[model samples]
Target: MKEKLGVVPFWQGYDRKEVLKIARIAEDLGYESIWIPEAWGYEQFQLLTEIAKETTRIKLATGIANVFSRSAGLLAMSTATLDEISEGRVILGLGTSGKNVVENFHGTPYRKPLTRLRETIGICKTLWRGERLTPEQSTLAELRHFKLAMTPVRADIPIYVASLQPKAVRELGRIADGWVPTFWPYEHFNEGLEWIAEGARDAGRDPSEIELAPFLGVVPIEDVDFARSALKPMISFYIGGMGTYYHDMFCRFGFTENADLVRDLYVAGNKQESIAAVSDDLVDAIAICGSPEHCRERLGEWRANGMGHGLVGLSPGATADSVEFILKAVAPA
Candidate 1:
C-alpha cells in the first residue's frame, strides 16, 4: 500500500536549485506531496510555482503561511493562483505562528488568533464560492465585500491548519480539511485525535472528514553519528527561539526537564549545549531521522497510528542523493 507520505524541503540556508531537486526527486519516487514553508526571505507561492514548473503529479502546500500576516482574501487569491498554476493540487496550510513572529516579524498584533482563524477560513471559502466577502466577515470596513475577480481552478481547495494548542486543534478539526500539526508527540496521539473527534461531534460533522496529517522532522543521513543528531539544532532553535508555545507543549508532552534545559541553553547562546540537550526521547516524539531502514520503520509507526506524515527537512542534509534514497526507501507503495 502506498502511504501517501509527503516531504518538506530544507527551506532556508540551502541552495534554491537543490530544493527544487528534492521536489523533483520526491515526485519521481511517487511521494504524495511537497510542503513549501515561507520564512523571512522566501515566498511560498513563488516557490510552489517553481516546483510546479518542475513536476506534475505531487501536490503542493504552504506548509503554513501564518494567518496574521496576510488577509484571508489575499491568502485565498494567492492560493487560488497557485492551484491554477499547479493544475489544482494546492493545500493552503494556515497557522497562528506564535506571538513573536506575528508582532516582531510581521508587525501585526496576534490578537484573537482563533477568532481570526475561524474568520479567515470562512472568508476564504466564501470568496472561492464566488460570493462577496462582507466587511462583517473580514472586519475591514474599508475593503468592501468582494468576490474573486478570476475563476479559481477549484472552488474548494483543501485547507490544512497547523495547530498545537487544544483550542486550535479542536478548531481545525471543526473546520479545516486537514490537520497539519507540528511537534505533535507520538505518545498522546490518540488524545489529539479525540480532541478532533469531540470538535467534529460538537459541530455535527464527521470526524473522519478531517484528515489527521501530522508533521514529522524526517532527515535520513548516511553517517551513523551525524544521523543521530540530525534534527537537534533545528529542533532546539524552534523550542527555544520560535516562542514559548513549543517549550510549553513539550512540557505537556512529559519532557519538561529537557524542554526547559534546551530552551535555557539555546536562549542563553549556549548553542552546542542546547542542541545537545535535545533528548532522544523529545526528538523521537516528533522526528524520524536516521538510515533508510530506520526512517521506514519510524514512518510506519506514524502511518499505522492513523495519520499521514509530512516529512519536514529536520536535517539540512537533504541533498540530491539523500533525497533520492530516502524518498525511494519511504515510498508509499
Candidate 2:
C-alpha cells in the first residue's frame, strides 16, 4: 500500500478520456507506475503512447500484452520504440492469454505456451541487445535477419510475466525480472514465492532479484456486503468462464470446493448462483474491500507479506473519488 503500488485502470468499463484522467491522477498522487491492459478493447501500445506523452514521471507497463497477438521480434521492436518514447520508463509485461482470446479472438493456435514464452523472451532480449534474430531462436522467419533500426533507450527493459500455474510461475522466476500474479491470496503468497525462488536458485540467480508485483482487485466501501457482492461477478467470470487452467490454479490455491461449485453453477447457466457462491472469505482472500480503515489494515498485511510493487484494480462500482481516497489512504508514508 506504499508508493510501491501501481495502478492498473483496465480499459474495459472506462472510456479513453476517463482512463487518461485516472492515469494522470495516479501519477500525481505518487503511484509508482501505470499498467495498461490489453484484452480486446484498446491496443495497449497506443494507449501507453498517449499516457507517455501526457505524464512525465510514472513508469508504464502493459499489465500484460498478449504473447499470441504478435511475434517476439515485433514485440521487441514495439517495446523498444515505446521505451524510447517514454524516455526509458517501460516494463514489458507479457502473458499467454487464455485459449478463448488466443484461438477465438486472435485466430492463432493455442499450443506450446511454455515454448512460446521461452522463445519470445530469448528473441526479444537478443534483439534489444542490438543483435540480429537467429532462426533457431525464433518461430518467425521474417525476423531471421531483422535488426531493430532504432536504438533503444534501455537495452534491458524489465520483463514481468503474468502467470498462476506452478510451472509457469517457476519459469517466470528463472527468467523474468518480475511476476504479475492474479487472484493470489495473501495466505498462500509465501508458498507461491517459494516456487519462484526454487526456480531462481536452480538458475543460479538470487531470489531477491525477482520482483513480486501482484495484480489485486480492491473495492473500498463501508458496507462489506455491497463490496463483496460487487466483486463476485468479476471473480465468477475468471474462475468460471476464463478456462480450466485458472480453475485448476484456484483449486491448487486452496479453493478446490469453491472453485468446483462456482464452475458447475456458472457453466450450467446459473450465473447469479455462481456469483452468490463466491464466499465472503474467498472474496476477501483475493481482494481488499470494506471501509477505508479495513482496507488500510489489509494492505498493511499485504505489505508485511513482502509485496514489493503491485498493480491494483479499483472495482467497477467504485467512484473516482473512492479511488482517490484509497490512493491517499494507502500512499507510502
Candidate 3:
C-alpha cells in the first residue's frame, strides 16, 4: 500500500512570513501534516498557531514540546488552546527532551522521563475531556477533581509520544494516541513495534490502534557525495554534542562502545573524522538519501514497517521548490 508523507520545518532562521509560505506550499502540495519543532528559536505554539491559521487542510503538530519545560496543567492548557484554534486539527507531540535541553535550557532536572511523560499525558487528556484538575505532586497520581472553566471545542485531540528508547516507545503504545520516533531505520522498527505491542497488550489495547509517526533526515540529491556532505553537520551535531552521558541517541544505534570517542572527536573540531566515524551503513539505515527513486524505495520500507505517518525532515539546502519536486516524485497520487 502507498503511504502518506508529511514535512517538518527545520526552522533555521526563517521569518514568520517565510515559514507561513512554506506551510501554504506544503498544504497546497497535499502533505499530510506540518510539524514545528521547539528548541532555540521561536516558540512552538506560536508558530503552530500561525501555521494553523495559514493552512486549512494539513494537520499541525508540535514536533515536540518538552515535558520538563512546562507544568502538566500548563502544557495541557497549551494543547487545549491550540486544539481550539486549529479546530481539532492538532496533534500534541510530547517528549522528555534530553538533559541538555531540560537542565541547560529549561532549568529543570531531567529525572524520570518515563514517569513525567505518563503524568503529562494523563493530565492533558483529563483537561481535554473538561475534567476538573487539582494540583498534584506525584507523577502517577490522577487529579481530575477540577475542570476547565472554558469548554473545549473538541474533547478528542491525538497525543503522540516522541520516544527514542524501547521502554518509552512501549509506554507510548500503552497510552498515547500515536508514536513519534526520530532517526529510526525502517528495518529496525519491527523490534521497537514488538515492545509497543507488548505495552498495548498489557494495557488491554490493540497495538494496531496506535499511530506510528517516524521522522528522519531526507536529502534527495543525485550526487551521493554532495548528499553526504550536506548531511555531515547534522550527523556531527547529533552524534557528537546533542547530549552528554544521559541524552544521546547514538548509543542506541550500537555506538555505545565508541560513543564517547565519537563525541570527543566531534567536539574537538574533527568534523570530517566524526562524519567518517558514522558508518555508511548507519547513514543509509537512518537517513533517506540518494536519488528520488531510491528515496521512494526507502519510503516503501518505512510503510512496510507499519509507519502510519511519515514526516520528512528535509535537508537544509532543499528549497521549497525542490522539496515540492521531491515530494511529488516520491508520494503516491
What lDDT score belongs to each candidate, Candidate 1 first?
0.81, 0.84, 0.77
RMSD for all candidates, in order, please: 2.0, 1.9, 2.6
| Candidate 1, 126-169: lDDT as tens digits | 88888886767755324576799999878899898888889888
**Candidate 3: residue 231 lDDT (0-100):** 67
Best by TM-score, which number?
2
Better structure of 1 and 3 per lDDT = 1
Q: By TM-score, how accurate is candidate 2?
A: 0.94
Kindly report which residue stretches of model 2 are placed more than 4 angstroms away from their true locations once superposed.
Answer: 139-143, 316-322
TM-score of 3: 0.90
**Native-to-model Cα distance after best TM-score fit, residue 278 in candidate 1, in Å:** 1.6
TM-score of each: 0.93, 0.94, 0.90
lDDT digits (tens) for residues 258-307 of candidate 3: 55666778889997787666655666777777897887787777788788
Clashing pairs in 3: 132-146, 132-147, 133-146
When summed lDDT is taken over every stretch of 10 residues in candidate 1, the lowest stretch is: 309-318
* C-alpha positional error of residue 99 in candidate 2 after TM-score superposition, expressed in Å: 1.6
Instruction: Compute the lDDT for candidate 3.
Output: 0.77
| Per-candidate total of colliding backbone pairs | 2, 0, 3
